[model samples]
Target: MLGQIDITRRQAEIADIVQRSGFASVEELAERFEVTAQTIRRDVNGLCELGILRRTHGGVEPPASAGNIHYSTRQILNLAQKKLIADLVAADVHDGQSLAFSIGTTPEIVMQALTGHEGLCVFTNNLNVAFTASANPSCQVTIAGGRLRPGDRDVVGRSAYDFFTHYKVDIGIFGVAGVDEEGTLLDFHEDEVSARQSILANCRKSFLVLDHSKFGRTAHVRGGHIRDVSCIYTDRPVPQHIQALLEGSETRVVAAQDTV
Candidate 1:
């Protein structure tokens, strides 16, 4: 039996890991903490009740939205790499080209990179992206209408999907939480997935911006397949299996300052 202080500290550590990794299994958390599975389950249940964690199939994850990890945490996770990929993708955007920005830290960085572009029409479900891009003197920013996620400052659901259906953009910029072995794009929320699918179906060309950390990660929902993307911009090399999939499909991989 652990003391109150010990239990508190251990739970805190467990929450930190789940926030950083996006997901953690009960058995793995048990082994890592040197505790029995039953004990870990108790801790997870408590955390879930407190709204610090969400129960998944055989593990726990950060809450789907609003209760997700902080934007600051997401911002700092891959700052340098995100900036590199943002620069590479932004360079592709020409003046007067219309673009849609998805909800993610990477898309926010890309919005920053697009500052001062002339005659550009930008549509986004991310409130942060809309506000930031609005600061560009020559850009027109349109935000999707829907239930807002105060946590991430984004919009989702049918309203957002309907908004995207009205206009087809020249470019669609998106981010994913995971890319599975078969090259499917995965994310945490089904509503966001639906929004992404709408953007993919309407856009002339689509680009996925991601870091290497997403390579083997797992998420609950599938947004779409990689073959639907026109290109992928990343800060690291694509893993061999994913690379093979891209090569056999229509997707082109763009690596920035990649070592692997």
Candidate 2:
């Protein structure tokens, strides 16, 4: 799996173009980037293989499915942005608080950021989060029981939902698979949506943590709205459409860069 650092500048730009515009032909991308058609094809092919883009008849487009990218790839994609968001979330977190974390790479990064905090009670269905939070000796970690998903390193389903229903935590931090234009919170699986809903219902303050890439993305399962969360933490300002949806609501948007 190629990390963010391994992706070339041209390749990265190509990905951005496709993601934003929906599709870009080889010739058009080459002309836009001032590269040869062959070079553009190479880049598109590589991205397609990584599941970052899907190859069409004469162009490349964002993956047209409800499923998310592979877990290994997701771990490395936008890693720096995720870390920045994590730092912001950690800074807002104080010691001696109970936190409910949901499954996803960003939340795992948050767990890493919170490792220095003392006296935390962490409940999560993500094994990665539990392991990271356990690094802090003063933290108490309780993991949900379910069949483990080896690829994502998390547990979901009825057991996970029931586990979260049993506790009301100070903070609930979770990441969504996508946020549509209507502000609908989306996830790839029903189990994931159930677990997230459990966290939102049980937590005193719900924090929706996601990077800019998730702004207009799509997913299969939909169960909540962005307004349901107390705050949103992202690496960049949300799109104007999404901003409009937050109007008249108390849900605060926090861009990580603005904190610095």
Q: After superposition, which runs of candidate 2 have C-alpha atoms over 4 Å from their true positions?
A: 1-66
Best by TM-score: 2
Q: Model 1, 75-146: lDDT tens per residue?
A: 645666788998888888899999988888888888888886788999999887888877777889889987
Q: CA lDDT of each candidate?
A: 0.83, 0.88
Residue pairs of candidate 2 with colliding backbone atoms: none
lDDT of 2 at 56: 88
lDDT of 2 at 172: 100
CA-RMSD of model 2:
4.3
Error of 2 at 117 (Å): 0.5
In order of listing, the candidates' clash counts read: 0, 0
- TM-score for each candidate, following the candidate numbering: 0.74, 0.78
